[model samples]
Target: MKSVDATEFRVGGSDGWTVTTSFNYNQWAEKNRFQVGDSLLFDYDSGKDSVYQVNKEDYDKCHTEKPIETYKDGHTSIKLDETGTLYFISGNCGNCRKNEKMVVQVMACRGSCNSAASLGYLSCLGVVGAFVASLLL
Candidate 1:
């Protein structure tokens, strides 16, 4: 299980998941630097609001119908397992049309796995494996 104490972000902060204001989300994400090991927690009323993971094009278009993934449990946790551009929007059409969306640039973890390795990216487990292999040799 990923540690809740670690790099996790509560979407919308003190106001929870509801769009207090577009500026709230904008300011919340401004100072945050997301990494592969981090996660996002969305807390809201599922009936009126939903979270949609989408692509840039879809996000820009506010196309909430077809999403890369959908979460509507009110409290959702999405782990960042890869590094790239990640886009999320409100699945509720009106809320989305009003521009309730977020774009995050997920970056690779910088500490243990910072390298141009053959397989490209490695998780913390890979770092451990490398350490173990060194010990064996």
Candidate 2:
């Protein structure tokens, strides 16, 4: 996640999912599109106090039972496992009205087998290619 300002954050993909701090709920959701096995990181800003909570709809689908709290200038991580939409909000009362909510879209693998087998096959091919190259040398 990237910090845009004292009260803003952003997300980007490094080895995984990434996001940027959004000013509104809809903006956040559009920016950070979540997938299964992905995670969301909230990087809080200093001095500017804030609180974050997931939307009730998201909590129900994921069976996430937790209360919201004030956020610090660091990283808050949330993992996505199921396929659905996740929403979040800053519980900062008046501040919330000033654009302080986040959302994410989580998608699951489509087919039964999906791309797992394909990935494995590609890995095997890579190993074979390396071995053949070594033998030739």
Candidate topping TM-score: 1
lDDT of 2 by residue, 12-128 (tens): 323112123433446546865456656666655434533455666533342224544444445667655568866665444344445455556776643332344445555576877
lDDT of 1: 0.77
Give Cα-based local distance difference scores for all models.
Answer: 0.77, 0.48
Candidate 2 lDDT score relative to the true structure: 0.48
Work out the TM-score per prediction. Answer: 0.76, 0.47
lDDT (tens digit, per residue) of candidate 1 on 71-90: 99999999888889888999
Provide backbone clash counts, one per model.
0, 11
In candidate 1, list every pair of residues with a backbone clash: none
Candidate 1, position 35, lDDT: 85
